[model samples]
Structures are given as structure tokens and as C-alpha cells.
Target: MEEKQIKTPHEVIASGGNVIKTRDDHSLILVGSDGTVLNSNECSWISDDKDNAVDNKLFRSRIEPWLTSLFQSEHLSLLCGSGITNAISSLAGAGTGTTMGETTFTNYKNEIVSAAQESAQASGREKGNIEDQIRVANDLLRGLKIIKDQNAAQLEKELNSIISNFAKSILNSENGIATAEENKRENAYRVLVNFLLSFASRTGNKERLSIFTTNYDRLLETGAELAGIHLMDRFVGNMMPIFRSSRLNLDIHYNPPGIRGEPRYLEGVARLTKLHGSIDWIQNGGEIRRIGLPFGAKAITPYLEAPGLDNANTMKLMIYPNSAKDRETAEYPYVELFRDFAASICRPNSTLVTYGYGFADEHINRVIHDMLTIPSTHLVIISYNDPIGRVLSFYSESAHKDQMSILMGGNLGDITNLANDYLPKSAIDRATIRMAELLQHRMGATSGLDKQATARQVSIVADVSTSEE
Candidate 1:
């Protein structure tokens, strides 16, 4: 007898078995005996573009091998991990070094030992005084080691204290739900702050410098404050003073004494330009009031400053998400501020380095796209995900595919490459050579300049057009 094919859900389940059912409309459902549906076919399995997926897979296949080869070596892993651990340890210690302090001392001692040995070898003398010097050096090294150990213990205590406080704050007696969003914001701020610090350290000089962020959070300001750099947030003329005060007072310890003076616009420091209103800032009674800083440090002054507008409330300074194009008028000082920011970044030979920002906001994206159109401007997008680059690439191609061959041509890579590429070649190359020397001078410096440097060098190659003219 031929076996009856399982057709209907009831027929298949009746034989004391599970049944898989597909509807006439290509919907899939798994049903059990008692009319229990396991999975309903609400979503389609096939994606929009199978070719794109295939292309990505192929690209990954080619790139993964190279990445694996680059990172797979045992020595590379050890060195990378050691470097990261050292950095984390140093940051964890902050003003004081615990484990990092010891590591640093150990490193210094090793250097001293190597230098002394070389000196002894060159002199060709078994001088007893040299032995004594070595002993003294050893004694000093031992002292440093002791100090480091003590520091480490102190750091652990401090960390434990902080952790305990954080735990107490997070676990409320009343509400069972955690402040997860607050924590996430805090974490995001930390990450952004670190990136800004790194950027400032790299680009800051005795020349003109500025930073503009559309975020309302004080993360950038906090990071700049920790790094001992003054952060100035540009709001509407009315809102500037309050925002400035709030940012300045974020950390009382870091706030410069007597901050009542006129805002001294300094060069070579972190200038935070907040296109949108800040979290701590509030518009009240035709005036702006900036509240406590991060970690809840209250401002000494009221910080209730007003811009030049007569109707401050009507001015609409804060640009929230989903802001319509109708809001982009001269009446809106915040909008004007964003336009000014775009102008500042679009200056000759100016390079904009963006971190974690997807440029999805049409307003910001349009500004960036316009900047790219400028012959003198370069854009360096540093995103953890490919979405920013992909979007930018798409825009670039859509706008100027005929003119420029590369999509997102200006060193559009990940965070590390973005940091390395944004600076002058001389600076980056010098850093590279110095780092190489530190690691092992015997290896010598890596030959050939990076792409940016090479491009600059080529542009300056005898000025053939001028010669012809």
C-alpha cells in the first residue's frame, strides 16, 4: 500500500506526530496536535538583494584571509594584547599608576640596565664603582617596584570604592528596573570622550582648532575637561553662556579658577560646538539655564544666560530629531550655528574627522556632502560599522561619481586608520618611525610613505602647471 502524504495540519498531527504546514500564499507554520502553532511565516526568508550578499561574502572571503594573516601570529597577538592591557591599566590608574606604574618602572629599569651594560662594555673595565652604581640602580629600581605595588593596591581600593558606589546607585530600593539607558548613555559618552581626547592629542597645536558636535550629551565636554582642555559649546547667542558654564562646571576639580571672565577663544584646544541643545541645558523664562555637570557637580553660578534674541522661547534653539526643513531659517539660531559649523569645516585644507556618527540626519549629511564638493576639504569618517561609509559612498557616487573615482575617497576607514590618516604625513610618519625605534631600531623604519603623504608629495612635485604657465 502506498503511504499517504501528509497534507493538512490535522491529518499529519493525528498520527501522534508533528506537522509542518505551508499555506497557499507561501506562508509557513508548524502545528502540534492541540492546534498549537509554533512559528507563523510573518517574515520573508529571502533578502532584497542576493547578489549583494554574495558580493559581501566574497569580499569577506578575500579580506578575512588577509586579516587573519595580519592578526593570527602569536607574537602579534601577544604584543597587541600587552599594549591594550597596558593602556587600560594606565587609564584605570589615571593620575596614579598601579599595575601600569610598575610596568612603566620595569620598562625604565630595563632601559637603564641596557644603557649601563653598553657603557661598561665600551669602557672595557671591571670597575668596582660601576658595580656599585649598578647596586645603587638596583636599589632605586626596588624602591620604584615597591611604590608601584603600593599604587596598585591603592588603585584596587579606589576601584572597589567606585564599583560599590555605582552598585548602590544602580540598585534602587524602590524601583526594581535598572537605569540601563542612563548607563548606556554614560558608556557611550565615555567611548566618545576617549575618541575626542585621542583626536585632540593628535591634531591640537598652537594653530587654529575647533570641534563641533550635534549631540546634546556632555560626553565630549566631559572628555575634554578630563583631558584639561577648555570646551566651548556654540549655541544661539542667548544660550551660549549657560551652555558654556554648564560644560565648564561639569567637573569642579578641572574647572579653571575664576571662570567669570569673557570667553577667551583659544587656539590649539578642544572647542566643542553643540549644534543642538545640551541635556543639562533648559530654556526657562526667555533665558537658558544649564544645570549640574556630569557626576552631578552643581554650577556655582545660576548659568542662566540668554542669547541676543528678544523672544528666546520663540527662537527655538534646540534641534531635536525629525526636525523639519521648515525649521531651517535665520530665525533659528541653532540652525544658523550648524550652517556656520559647516562653513568652518569647509575651509581650505580643512579635514573633518567624525567618530560614531552615521551622518543619517539629512541636515548634517547635506552639509557633509557640500563639504566634499569643496576642492580643499577632506572628510575622514570613523565609524565602527560600515553603514556610515556605505551611505557616504552612495551619496558621493550619486553626487560626483563622474569626477572622483573612489567612493568616500578621503581615508574612509575604521577608527584606527582614521586616527592615523587625519594627521599630517610628517607627523604620522615621525610617530611611526619613533614607535618602530622604540620597539626595535634594528628592524628599521617601514619604507614608503602612507597614501595621504604620498598624494601630497605628488601634488608638490615641481608644480608642472606653473612651470608650463
Candidate 2:
């Protein structure tokens, strides 16, 4: 038997190219050197036989130490990958990725981690004091920010260095492993999608579904798309381009150069709201633009850099690290969306299922607290590190004592328990096991109902019988 070839990161990068594309099923497919297609089938090995488990012990054995090292190291902070922002935010001190503190901490941590890793590599086994390294990293990060604020063009070179350093550290770490077979990326993606679907389905009473994430990657969108759901991001605009066209017709139908419509929503899915911008989004002049998935569709052309911070007008929409108050302004569509989403989900009888998201952001924390205050609302938080019930215990307040439930295991079975314990048993039957499932089921049903009603001749039908009667 011939031994299969294994490619190293150096070899992959040196080869000069790789393509990270989503498969038809919404799972990621990485095309590396020599046309190697790394898909879910190849990557699912990390979980052993427990394919549906979120926190596979074997998987964690590889992930935990890598993550712990990254966090503990003084040199690395911002870990950017496809849909990684929210996950990073959850692990950072900020808890919630959407909050100002969480966002800032993510950037800060990235910078620090970058510097520390560089120093460690250079020192070569002479372990430095973690605190000292953190201080140094923080100083460097602050200095980079100061340079940016001063609008020093030369400072960009230094900023690039900091960013590059952080990237290198992550790439060197185990978490940086991108290959399907090595990283178990497929399992993680599956778990995430399943959780979202189930949560959305379980909360049938929710009129609208809102998701706020800091991840720049397309995993969530891809997952939603595969599951036949529509996603909306304030920065990205509406997923349903039809709505954009309708709005444009009201303003520019008679204009000389015909106005191009924005992205539209999916027919049946709930709305997707991205708090941070997406990787595919671009900014030009002052207008934000996005790439079209359709083959013949013209790429969106913006007047400004798609989401550049250098442009004063464009900066508002960009997800830069800052304080909570800074994020509440209307100019920052993402921030506004976050606030609105919080209000919507915090209503009475609402249920929020937070999976990988840790309560790190104070802004999001406040929102959660508000939700907990509602008498009818329920909170279900799933974490591998802590039991679900105990996880909610961390947010202890006089009012929220009995309001939240925690599912404290690492498997999908825990999710089943979490849903059953917090939600009425009757609700579980209608509940989904993944985010995509809920979006598909709800959107499909709603669309069908709308069509059926519109097809009927009678405008109004009186109910002749009632259960009470």
C-alpha cells in the first residue's frame, strides 16, 4: 500500500494558493495543493464515533491546549478565520462578541498574542513572564491604535507588522490547523449549525429571528443558505435583493443610470443580522459593496472602501474595537441592529440559546440581564466547561435566580436535555436540532401559508367552530 502524502502549512503556503469554498450542503471545502479537496468527510475523524457531540473529548484534547496556549501567551490576540470572530469573543474576557468590551478585547488580545508569540519564538524555550508579556503586547497594541488615530500613513507599516505577527502566531498554533482531517473543522461546523437550527425551531413563538455575530466568515450565512433560510446584516444590507429593488424603485426608477438593487432575503427563513461586517463585503468611497454569488451578476460597486476605517463616513459601519457607548450610534448600522435584536429577543416568552458564545461583552451582558428580567422569558446557555444550570449561575442577580437554565455537557444529548428542561415538553416536538432546520421549516411553512391564503377567493373567512364553543 502506498503511504498518503501529508502537506505541512509551510508547503501549503509556499505552493502559492488555496481556495476555501462552501460546498452545496454549506459545509466548507478547502482546496489545497495538488487539487486536494478537504471536506467534512475527511475532517470528521476528530470526534470518534460521537458525530453529533459538540464537545468531543478527543477534539478538545487537541483544541483546549491550543486555545489555552494562545490565550495564555502574551503575543497573540485577534484570531481571524471563516466565522471565527464570535467564537473568539466568547473565549475572551468580554463574553459576548457583539459588545464593545468584547470587540476591543478581541483586537487587544490578538495584538498581545501576536507579540508574545513572536517573542517566544525568538527566545526559543526561555519562557518569559506571562504578565510582563501581556503588558508589552498591550503597549504595542495601544501604540498602533495611537498611530492610526494620528493618521500617520507610515504607522500603517507598523500596524501591519502587529497584525501579521498575530496571524503568524495563530497559524503556528494548533487552532490554526485548517485541514479537514487534522482540525476537525467539519464537526465543529456541523455542531454549530445543528444547535442554531434546534434553538430557532424550539422558539416557535418568536416572530423574527435575529442573530448577532462578529465572525467575518460566511459559515453562518452558508449554513443558513443551505438550510433554505434568509440572513440579513445591517452592514451587508438585506439578503433579499427584491426588497432592495422595491426600495430603489421608490427612489431611482426614472434615474439615468439604472440603480442596482441590494441583496434580498430568502423566501422563508428568518432574518440574519451581522453585527460585524463580513469577509466578502467591500467598501469604496463612502458606499459599502458586496460580491454577488450569481455568475452573471455585476459585482457591487461602492463609492467608498466597502468598510474602511480610514474614511470618516465609512468608519462608522466598520467593526473597530471601542467602548459600548461608541457602538450605540445609528451611524453604525451593526450597533443599531444589535440593540434592536436585543430588544426583540428580550421580550417576554423569548428563549435564547447561546452555544459557543461566552458572556464576555458587557453590552450583550446587559441585554441578557434585561431578557432575564422578563418573567416569561427563558435563557438556555450550553457550554462544555460548565453545566448548563451552573453556567447561568454566573449571571446571578436577585431577579435572574430562577430565570435561566444551563446545559453543562459536551454532547448533542445535553442540548436535548437543555431544551426539554427549560422549554415545555410539547415544544420539543416542534423544535429543530439545528439552526438551519428551524429556518427552513419556518420559512417554508410561512411562504406556503401566504401563497395558500392569497390563492383563496374569499378575503375573509369566519370561524364557525371554536374549541370553546
Which candidate leads in lDDT?
Answer: 2
- The CA-based lDDT of model 1 is what? 0.36
What lDDT does the true structure give each of the candidates?
0.36, 0.37
For residues 197-295, what per-residue lDDT tens digits would candidate 1 score against the true structure?
444432212223456655443434545665566554443343234432222212112223687553332322544556655544555545555543333
TM-score against native, each model:
0.40, 0.45
Candidate 1 TM-score to native: 0.40
Q: Candidate 2: deviation at residue 94, Å?
A: 25
> Candidate 2, after superposition: displacement of residue 242 in Å?
13
Clash pairs (backbone) in predicted model 1? 237-307, 238-306, 238-307
Locate the minimum summed-lDDT window of 10 residues in model 1.
72-81
Q: In model 1, which runs have C-alpha deviations exceeding 4 angstroms?
A: 1-194, 202-207, 235-240, 243-268, 293-319, 328-331, 386-397, 401-469
At residue 448, give the lDDT of candidate 1: 56
